[model samples]
Target: MTTAPGSTRNETAAIGDGLRGNAEELLRELAGPAARLRDDQWVAIEALVVDKRRALVVQRTGWGKSAVYFIAAKLLRARGRGPTVIVSPLLALMRNQVAAARRAGVVAATINSGNVTEWDEIHRQVASGAVDVLLVSPERLNNPDFRDQVLPRLAADAGLVVIDEAHCVSDWGHDFRPDYRRIRTLIADLGTDVPVLATTATANDRVVTDVAGQIGTDTLVLRGSLDRESLHLSVVRFDDAVERTTWLSGHLDELPGSGIVYTLTVAGAHDLADVLTSHGHRVAAYTGQTDPAEREMLETALLDNEVKALIATSALGMGFDKPDLGFVVHVGAPSSPISYYQQVGRAGRATERAEVVLLPGPEDTRIWSYFASVAFPREHVVRSVLEALDYERPQSTAALEPLVELNRSRLDMVLKVLDVDGAVRRVRGGWLATGQPWTYDADRYERLDAARTAEQQAMLDYQQTTGCRMEFLRRQLDDPALIGAAPGSGACGRCDSCTGIHRDTTVDTEAVAATRARLDRPGFDLAARKQWPTGMAKLGISLSGKITEGAETGRVLGRLNSLGWGRRLRPVLDGPDAPVPDEVVQACIPVLREWDWTVRPTAVLALESPDHPVLTTSLAERLADIGRLRNLGTLYLRPDHPPVSAVNSAHRVAALYDSWEVPDLSRTDGPILLVDTLTDSGWTFTVAAWTLRRAGAPAVLPFALATPT
Candidate 1:
């Protein structure tokens, strides 16, 4: 074992070779016969097993962070210490970590949503001292049953605790997750003697400090170099989505072995994967929406090089191991450099060289702003959530949704923040108020939001910078070592700026035409809402159960978030005073041709749009003119009943309940096409169609220029 710098010879001798041999043996099992532990890895393992000290490791990806914990768990178990408890963030990560543990001869078991049937057996194994490591999702920490029953026991007896992706524990981290905040309490509950380790690949200096403070006092933070010698970085600027998609389709094959192609949105991932597959590239789309079983298959396919790429969102990132991944191409820039680095880090891990390219698009900023808009809800929203809580009874998030204006995801995030503040607690059934006084940390949230905005700006700057791209990224993370390096000295000499090797920045005119044709092929399925949202009667809407008569599955020109016609359709739908544009009206013809409806609409009906009446009416009139159907005019909005923004089905249904009146039900016969400027939450369409159906329309066909997904 390598002694600490300045350790006395006698002290080094006393530590002996047996401990070193064990660690070396564990490393051999993990990384092969020639493997040896880095000095930092050995130090971290010794700190956990021998010294029983808390350690925070902030190393780059594929730097053997998992090896430290796995080896430490093995050594601790040999000495009769209880199983190491790991707070992992994702199922992909847990699966990989568990596999890594087994290779090291450590019996690791996981308890996550994927295997509820196996959780009992896993818990029993941990209790029986048969497991060396226990991997769990951070959200599991807040599970009612787990928190109320199992957590205390685990906390008291755990030999060592490892918080993987520890950057998440800090709200300032790029990908701040609410459930990760629960780890602070978990660590505080552990016995004093139990050692703790927190590891992350993407933390900046600020994140490191915040995470270390949460993990406890005198915490040892080991941050290594962020530079990736294997990465050949470049930024390719594109004027539009078609050009970018076309470029990817044209040049994807030029990139070395199988890797990842990241898209900012799930739709973008699927769309790009489709476009590439059409161009004969072997690729698959992976996203948060992917089924667990399918995700496993995709991961395995990438691992075995069965496919060239997994066109994915950030869901496929962090803890997915592919040693020979040859490239990472971003269809659009991520919101921040830190996040970008985390995704790109997945590539060039085990290889000496890998290509990293960024195709920055005109819509990138819009996407970034859209995400930023959801950051930290207003004070009123937070207070309203707290007000809706009952001290005597627990309320599920869905139950709380109707009582508060915040959407489900935003509400769940706020609830978690409240949980960490001790204002509420998760118990059996759902969440209940603790009746504790809570102060809204307005300043902190503002600062974090501002920090995010700043990060976005930093990414933009990174794109525009002419200097070393890698150095710029390193500096953005506030890597002190890189910051202190002489100006221009840290230049990687591998990026486009340094090497002057541009990889066909311009897409061929033919390729661009093909891509434009693909994008212009505007149509997306708009499935009818099957059932009314729960608890609608309480909101004074009698709607419940399955819909007896409603719109058949419909068609839209495109999603409001789609990279194709959405870019054109958004302004027309969202802008003021103007009529629906000629291009959008013309685009609808093809959608109409391709739409396979059960029954053809014989008449047209427009839903009243107080904000965009001209746009909505013009679209309906134009479509009626082209389709040779009777224009039956719009549903009339009740006086003084302006449009209300209801983010969920229950609230949306209540807002529009009895608000629309068909002027003449006698005239509303046969299938009528329902037209609207846009559909969000799909509640507007559902309610409008239901109203029309009740007014004696045989069937309704819903059409909108845009539907927000």
Candidate 2:
């Protein structure tokens, strides 16, 4: 091994001792008083700092995985090594890492979508060797400017490369992010002398195998026990949505400390947070739709224990660090056991006897099916994306969207898959075909899909398991220590099944009534579509610019995914064709009475619904009778038009361009009410409103019972 310049043999031995001292000092500074490095942590750090070899640490969360890299970076910098590069997955993770680095007296900076204006200064810091560590998201690896201009230099010069949440790089991992796959190429390009470290808390054996194989040759694998001593795991299954809502409302305050409440959908997150807020809890909703600034603020609020909880979706999962988080309660079960374990692992990290509960809902499977549809694109979609590319001219994703039916995200994923297969390349302008042979691995994708289905089934099984909850989870990860826990005695002795100590199942009658009342109350605005989607002309729809005359802002009882009334509304909207339900009719009365329309609808005009004709006609007739208005004959659909949601906005507008006609109106000059079953893209309502206005109606008020997210 080569030593640093200007160092003799005794000086080198002294320097080694100094390095150990430095690591110990930094560990205490980072982990606080009485902090000592675990043997496994020292092993991984030595392999990186002394051996200069690749390592994979698959320990549970709060296992001091960050400490290994931070201390290694500090020691390496002292030896004149270049700055360490950490490829993390979430902005929350990056934020935590930067703060942790600062406490250890290490200079750190980040380049992500949130800090575009500071990129130049950050780059200058990197150039000057003033930054000890640089954190970036995986997606930033594929940016045109970063990929072409900056990545090469970083790859060759970085002293250490860390892939945090490394399980995502494998296809078999629970949270398989396509952007993380780009790291394979980055790994292959790095200098052999540059030490690499990949750390994850949630990988099973299969995922660990795949990630280790991809990271490098002869990688050191460090696997630790998955047991979390502080967590008391339990499951509480409810017969229906109301019971679940009542349970959460009745027992939220009783949970030990400030933590996270996770939901399956954004609408669910918002609805649950709203219910909790009305019941006088300090809470906020966090999801993918939340603004970047607000997400940062919410994260801080949770860390400081300023709020009791933050109702959120999976967006808040992975790499959020709060050591003292008291509990983690799931409103709906995630589709996979690994995912569930990851979320629950966030709690009980630094506390004794923290509660982890799963309030499994009856709708979890249906929600799983909804997300499963986007798991992987069909073979035809992939082929179309490849076919659309030309070898000589690069075409941007937006330009290719007009030729292919896939959405932007799905297309981007297909392009990435092709890029990895060497069938396509991303150039200066966009993507171009490489004219290389590529085979779609039908069997591989099938296995992946089947694996996902099995994971979903495993999650369901977990809820019904009679064995130790923590033991079952560890076994799912193929933990080798399970054999030592005694056969048939793997129970943790802390779960509800083992201890007979469970949450109170009783619900307060008033709380249930209040929750029901809030759900039953109806009112959500259907903001009129003000502008046409761009590129409509290419789809044979000439209408462009803003629509000055269209449907007025309207109302729906609630979103289909909303906790309030959603359970009752879903069946009515999804059920067989029949007259509107009497209960739904009763629900709409309040919405009608509370509507503050500029012009009262004097006549009714029902939009044609081949699927729900009876519902629309009955709704229109009932509303006209109650409001004392005339029932104008309904508009008819042109033959051969597909359902509004069957395609994208451009195609939806094209199919409905000249598809509706008002057969006869008793009062053509008066404002009219247009009823439909549901609204998704709102283009259907837009075209219908334009048709009615052109047919001489003064105004149109659109109404629906539900709008899908």
Candidate 1 regions exceeding 4 Å error are 1-13, 574-576
All models, RMSD in angstroms: 2.3, 2.6
lDDT of 2 by residue, 1-709 (tens): 3354687768756766676777889999999979988888877887788778899999999999999999999988887899999999999999999999999998999999789999989988888888899998898888777887778878977989999999899899999888888888888889888899999988988999999999887899999888888989999988777778888888889998899999999989988888889889999999999998899999999999999999999999899999999999999999998988888989988898789999998888989998888766878878888887999999888667656776667778888778877898887899999999988899999999999999999999999987888988888887766756674466788998788777778888887888888766787788889977566666767777888878889888788888777887888878898899888888899898889998788888788887888989999999899898888857888666555443555656677888875666544667888888888778788889988888787899989888875
lDDT of each residue in 1-709, candidate 1, tens digit only:
3344577757765663577789999999999999888988887887777668899998888889999999888888888888899999888899988888889888889999888899888878877888888998988999988886778888988989999988888988988898999998889999888999999989898899999999989898888888889999999988878888888888888899999999989888988888888889999999999999899999999999999999999999888888799999999999889999999999998999999999988888888888888877888988988998999898888788878887788888889989988999988878899999999888998898889889989999998988999988888877756766787888889999888887777779998887777766788788888987777777877888898876788888887666677678777766676877788888899898898987788899898887888888889999999998889899878887866777755677788878876757576557898898877677777888888888788888999888765
TM-score of each: 0.97, 0.95
Q: What is the C-alpha local distance difference test score of candidate 1?
A: 0.86
Candidate 1 lDDT for residue 174: 87
Best by TM-score: 1
Evaluate all candidate structures by whole-model CA lDDT and list the values in order. 0.86, 0.86
Among all windows of 10 consecutive residues in model 1, the one with the lowest summed lDDT is 1-10
